[model samples]
Target chain A: MREFVPPSTRFVDLPDGFAMHRGGTLHGARIAYETLGRLNAARDNVILILTGLSADAHSASHADDPSPGWWEAMLGPGKPIDTNSWYVVCINSLGSCKGSTGPASVNPRTGERYRLDFPSLCIEDIADAAASTVHALGFERLACVIGTSMGGMSALSLLARHPGIARTHINVSGAVHALPFSIAFRSLQREAIRRDPHWNRGHYDAESYPRHGMLTARKLGMITYRSPREWEDRFGRARTERGLRTTDEPFAPDFEVESFLESHAHRFLRGFDPNSYLYLSYCMDQFDLGESCGSTTGEALSRMDLEKALVIGVETDILFPLRQQHDIAAGLSSGGTDVQFLPVDSPQGHDAFLSDPDRFGPPISKFLSVG
Target chain B: MREFVPPSTRFVDLPDGFAMHRGGTLHGARIAYETLGRLNAARDNVILILTGLSADAHSASHADDPSPGWWEAMLGPGKPIDTNSWYVVCINSLGSCKGSTGPASVNPRTGERYRLDFPSLCIEDIADAAASTVHALGFERLACVIGTSMGGMSALSLLARHPGIARTHINVSGAVHALPFSIAFRSLQREAIRRDPHWNRGHYDAESYPRHGMLTARKLGMITYRSPREWEDRFGRARTERGLRTTDEPFAPDFEVESFLESHAHRFLRGFDPNSYLYLSYCMDQFDLGESCGSTTGEALSRMDLEKALVIGVETDILFPLRQQHDIAAGLSSGGTDVQFLPVDSPQGHDAFLSDPDRFGPPISKFLSVG
Candidate 1:
């Protein structure tokens, strides 16, 4: 019910009466972000980092916040995305509970949480917000725009909607549009959240939150994010010493993998707002870059005027399969963009970008280091 | 919480105090089954069919039942199993709700529904009950034992535990043991059912069934049952006209895939007993063919004494991937049993045996016809 914003998070106010892609307008809406490294005199060294669902603006620890970030391994002084050379600006997604104006945020006009009353969100709106943040920072163009997971979708939207916003792009486990399988997984997650009686049509307060529903939704999300191969190697029929048991429940988390999911779900429960989660998830499902431009996905990709691009996909990603990354690469290649499509055989599935930085970092670092 | 048995279903009672694999016993317990053809005078010309978690004994329609059964396409007189030549007996899994003495059944000792009191069920227990059913029907051995999905695990158990129970075996989308991925999936499903407030620790009755939990569990099952490739071809990003909406919920089933899962989940909700479902799903996760015989999976598989075996796997099956089938075939082959590993490139995934009969039928028919 409450947003979990990092201490270092800063804000960029959108223009008054900012219109949403699917309709309605926001007054005094702002995007949350955090900056690392210093901008050059010309501002051409700026690297705009867009994030996936469930991430905040704190991509890494900086002077303002010493806490380790979600991408601490991949974004540091000498990491893949070397902060020393580039002025990195990571933006929290618009419809996220993490320091962003989402369903959890107070509606300025009504002075209440937006909840279900929040406007229908789209990937384009998220893209527009990120663009606005970049412009507000006085950067006409970014040296590179990096997007991972849902951020990949937003990155595509950013490039397609606002051509030349970035000189180069890096799409990590992203997609042009959600496949039916991905949609099915996300739809089930939303259903899990909504089906809880405590959800009370999005009216539950802090004490009466839909804990069970959110727990189930997060558990399902964990399953999809990681791959079977990684689990087989990591948890393979291993029993958990501390059983996830309640009274009279015979079927509890006996397996190590189930325990892993339970622990992760527990960590996620307090950090996110259920309503905000639903809105962002629905936005991802609705995102179709081709639909935004009224053209085929290939045509839409060909429209992006980037000087260079990098599309990285994990072979084991079930949510955004490797073929989707191939499609993006193929489309961008057709556009005469210097595109590098790196297919990583990481066993971590869709979450490889976050977990298997060794495989992900080199390609990103090499791509960013070039030109 | 009621069992939905076909009118033509028959029961074969086990001896007093039937022992379970994991410990505990079932007194006055019976196995539910239905036959498709006459038992030949030799009785050696019989095929025993074991089913997945939700299936009953009614594999096909009979004169008494009239209604079509689950495998209506492959089990009639002239169908793939060829009832004219093979007297086929399809046994409902021991822990299922369809006319079997399961969690939903009345406990003979207490004269009350067993519910969670149903002893720790295992694949070996299902196999033992199935073996007892075959023996009580006056057959020392079968022509072949066909196991599909969970039944495939049961079949492997049947063959391993009761060596020479069948002359030949067909393992369809089965595994020696569940992979961690499959366990995670089944664990979440059980969690979904148990988390339902109405579940009441498996005491939920007709009026207070855990509808939401069961719906979510069934929807997740449907997602894993079929392949992503099939959904891509069938649904893509297609929207549903009749949105699966409830009052005040914006994130309803919007995509065709979501609707498809929703419809399937709804149909299954009324048909299955949630307690029985949880018990059976747990049984699958606990099943390890090696654990039963106190050896490695390969070693245990080699212990099965059979003249021939055919392991059929679908390329797209995420639940029981193709490699598991190869492992089964290799193990059986190592035992000097004539084994054929046929990997079908079917897009229907784990449920291909039930849905994509075109790819599944020919191999089964050919395997049955030979010798």
Candidate 2:
């Protein structure tokens, strides 16, 4: 299992056309992925890593590019999913602004950026694209499928669409269905983008991006990702010395928390495409595997043919609360799947899956290693 | 104490110039207020009603307008601050857009809207204005000062500034100091306004207001004002019929919670001035009674010369958490003030002061009537 690390990135084209779950064909669709370790002779030791809304395919360092990846804490040699044993493939999601065929990608039909012309995406479409990528990699089934946040929803959708495609599923801080509070926030974030006059129907030049709207949306997302307790612990009512205003300046953020959000949101806006962010946010909110599988999570989970499942929830996650993880575990357990429900007690909230990987790693590693 | 109801809208010109806590003047300023019940010849039964960020001079129905006011449930004949027994005067705060002299008011110096040029406001400024209005009405001291949310902050500010102005204080869902989380959200909300192109440095025509930006800010405020439990009870994962999308449509809110926020936020935008909102929100975040006293609520309350006080907090309020109210009560109690802490079991969150007045009224009424 401890074979040579592959190149940092590899592209797999679904050439003839990749059929999207939402009734559209992604012609010349390509999935950009990075692999860790090596596939065994039987090609049955593969685990697919689906990332959160804002993450790319770089889950771990590779031979070609040795810089640490987004999930470097979890996916290194002898780590969780252990690059020493399991061959892990992390794909940039279908509708993301990464190397994937997303809104920023050029449409084959026209020599222009797809933008809104990219078929309306859903969680199922992301799952379908990942599944096709896995298939195209010569794997009949994955040893496990691990996803976080939006990736978790797509993972469930993957399970529902193609039974027995994955031997196990690791869902972290995700829901079977998006909650009302989250939907409301997501709707507002999308509106922020649409309302930006510079968006110009999503056809603005890449240089003159919708920074304000995207920054607002990112700040909103950042707020939801962290808990109130975390904010309090991190930044108390500590105000700046010079204050947000000088003698003649207008009002600005004087609090440290505002500074934190501004820094992170600015970083996010620089990297993300506004239209892709909108599409993916909608995809996450609109995803409901239950709707496709007889109207309930229990009904849908009953159809899931996974051998084992791991559901991890953070106590302080307001976006995807512990209740959602409980539902996932209960549904799988009722369906006779060996489901290990691990509630990570952390103040990090939803982002704990990424930030506090030490707590998440052991449980996830143990879950993935069982047969 | 039962006497005839007074007029609804009374404009008191603070023509000499109202001094701001931050060291500026509102010249030719006016205080718009409404009074209920008769001010006894002694003027001893008068009670002052301070409002949250958005409320007006009208806290309840009066002779000039028969329509039920925002707090009509808690201020009627048999209600908490019973109009039959107490002469109630609710003044629009100094920096509010409601009928008060705010950023929306015309500046006497230049004969233009004050906008950003309005004197930088703080909680004490509002308290001073309210106190001046009381003095103008010929009341040496108020029987009680009952305030909620931002009003509660103003009440505390009033106590800190002029110790014996009110005999009793009732604070509902308010804090002596704004927490970091609330400050962060408020910062983003203001940014939403500033970043909106239509805001045009706060000089946009009233008709072409920053609708989208204000809507975004309002939605953000609405989310924090309620709890996850309330949202679950209200909207769950209920999707609208015809779905969130029809054939060929752009993004729109498909969730009931989104609809709820949209309806209320739209109504809020129509009546509110953007500059006033920015000013008031900053005023709230900058309110720290501790800074004026001695670096703690305990120090501030120790100097408060009130006879009795009641502090009420809703269990689910994220904006002004129960811990804050607990701190206020503890601080006052420690300082030898007769403080009664009432913890309300409510799912309405910070807005419980307005929505769950049934629970709020009894304790408040009982406390106000004591002695």
Candidate 3:
């Protein structure tokens, strides 16, 4: 085991405009990343951590900014993705609002924000940017590449399209492509944001943001991200009686679940940009590792020459059902690749990957420990 | 069996202000209905068909208007709820905008559209208005009461709170109370409509309705109303080679599913009122048959005294899962009522009760024939 060290944030600039999958180009493309621990003298212990739709590069608390990262529970000394043994790097995806070259980023030619001017993005575009960041950091290969949800799809793309970037793969609650169910939900979210007159075709002023549309989109996302069981357990028909009944005040948040969504929506409205949200969510919908690789999702996974792979799925996940993870594992197994699939029983649903680190920590730590 | 006769549209005034469950009142409230076949001399052969949210009194074609209703697949001559035998009365519910006194109706006091000033509504209130319609029509008792989706909740309320209104009950994909999952979805839908600045707090002019917000809400609904399997089979990842791709035009409907939603949304916007939508959707979220019956869901259901019941649930319904229908059956059984719960295996999901009418017709027709 190696000693833990606080991660450092770094930015890598893609000097040339990055070409998008759908015949668009992103100029002055850059990715922000944070790395924990030190790379071994052999440079063989690097782990790339890809983020979901809204996460940044901050995977854990660092020395300068000791505030906990989103994945604070599972990335530290003696923790899964252990800083003690592996040099872990988490990169903010290309089209996100968080410290990345996105719609909010200024265009090189024009002095204004890219806004809708930013080229249309796809999951592979994000994966390509991550690959560039890894190469820029001077790493020949990685010990493993791990991702959850959108990040999981990105990792799959990296494994399928750009092989040998990582030795091992861990996909948590990720799909090979967007299922119709997810596509429908995401389509509605995008519609909600764009329909807001304030969105002004993604050209709204920063001060008077399209918060209402963003808030509604986030609420829809919050509903889909978690399982029905979780909501029932957490806030089943529970209401706060402090205010007049919701019957009288129909517009107010009545149920505890509504309040939960409202709180999350408010937080997201403050943190996320409307244009970046539309772009990234659309990218997620367009992601098809199978299409990127060759023919089918299974065929794509079968083509990956990984040392070992681990796939984690939750039972109650409606967004990315367990069958999707099973498909990935089966595809890899059929191709004679070493793979371990765990269908974890979790009521947390698609969000279990983030909320239930206990179920993930052991399997991840064990996989990293071997070889 | 009686000979089939086309129905006539009729409206009944409540005379005094109709009182709501939550203490709000709708003055000069009237219900619009269409009745088919002849009412037997005993006036006991009536099968009250409660319309779901967004549906009107037009459950079938009549002499005045030969156009098919929303449920055109069923409810014709020799069909389930057959005009050949049963005197079917389909009524537009109290809070709906279809010829009924609703938010769009002119207020007697202010001589303007009721809009938000319309009293807050609930399932029981809808049930109460339904009961009033039954009495006003001079039906000593109903042969059966049938409802689907939101109408299903109203039917449940009628059975549990206003007993003796019907001899038999058919509840399809309805719950005794709003689940947290559904409550969360409805909250987002309401937020989408209200947050639309064009909505102007439900005070928007009739010419320029909040169609965008309503469209988004309906799209969200369209996704939930059908199962993932149906979408995969119907639309898959199919994209048309129309104009430029979705990546080029982010705001446009590129996919077949999006197009389907857009087309349906446009139709709904043309026919429905935004304020009525808010009032009715909120009413659904507030529905709890148990509370109206002075107990828990199970307790309230157990308190019902019915001759018989047929509860239909689709295996793939995420909106109102089979478990909810099973609970309804179990509760009715606990009360010593003759209840037959049919878990119809269909890819249509929640809408299976409407879309898969062949399966429903057999069970429903058989039940009605026996009763």
i-RMS, each model, one decimal: 0.8, 1.2, 1.4
* TM-score for each candidate, following the candidate numbering: 0.98, 0.95, 0.94
Please, what are the lDDT tens digits per residue for candidate 1 over residues B1-371?
45699888999998889998778999989888999888888778999999999998999987878788999889988899898898999999888889988998899899998988999889888999998999899999899999999999999999988998999999999998899999888888888888888999888999999998998899899988999999999999888886666645688877889889878999999899998998889888888888888988888888778999999999999999999999999999988899999999989999988898988788889998999
For B1-371, candidate 2 gives per-residue lDDT tens digits of 01112246678877476778888888889888988887888889999988898888878887679888889898878788888889999988887777778888778899988878898899889988888888888888899998889999998988888888988889999899888878878888899888877888788776668877798889889988998889999888776665555554467777778778888898887777888889989989888888866577777887778888999999999899999999999998888889999999998999987887789888988987778
Please report the candidate that would top DockQ against the real structure: 1
Model 3, C-alpha of B76: deviation from truth (Å): 2.6
lDDT at residue B81 of model 3 (Cα atoms): 72
DockQ of each: 0.88, 0.70, 0.65
- Residue B357, model 3: lDDT of 77
| Per-residue lDDT of candidate 1, residues A149-200 (tens digit) | 9999999999999998888999999999999999988988888888888888
Error of 1 at B325 (Å): 0.9
- What's candidate 2's DockQ score? 0.70
Predicted candidate 3: interface RMSD? 1.4
Per-prediction count of colliding residue pairs? Answer: 0, 0, 0
Better TM-score candidate (2, 3): 2
Off by over 4 Å in 3: A1-8, A15-17, A24-28, A244-249, B1-7, B243-248
Backbone clash pairs in model 3 (N, Cα, C under 3 Å; residues 3+ apart or in different chains), count? 0
Clashing pairs in 1: none
Candidate 2 on A1-371: residue-level lDDT in tens?
01112346788987567777667788888888988898899988898988899888888777878888888999978887788788989988888877888888889899888988888788888888888899888899999999899889988988888889998889999888888888887888898888877788787776666778888899988988998888888888887666656654467787888878988998776677788888999888878888856578787887879898999999999899998999999999999899999988999989998888899989988877777
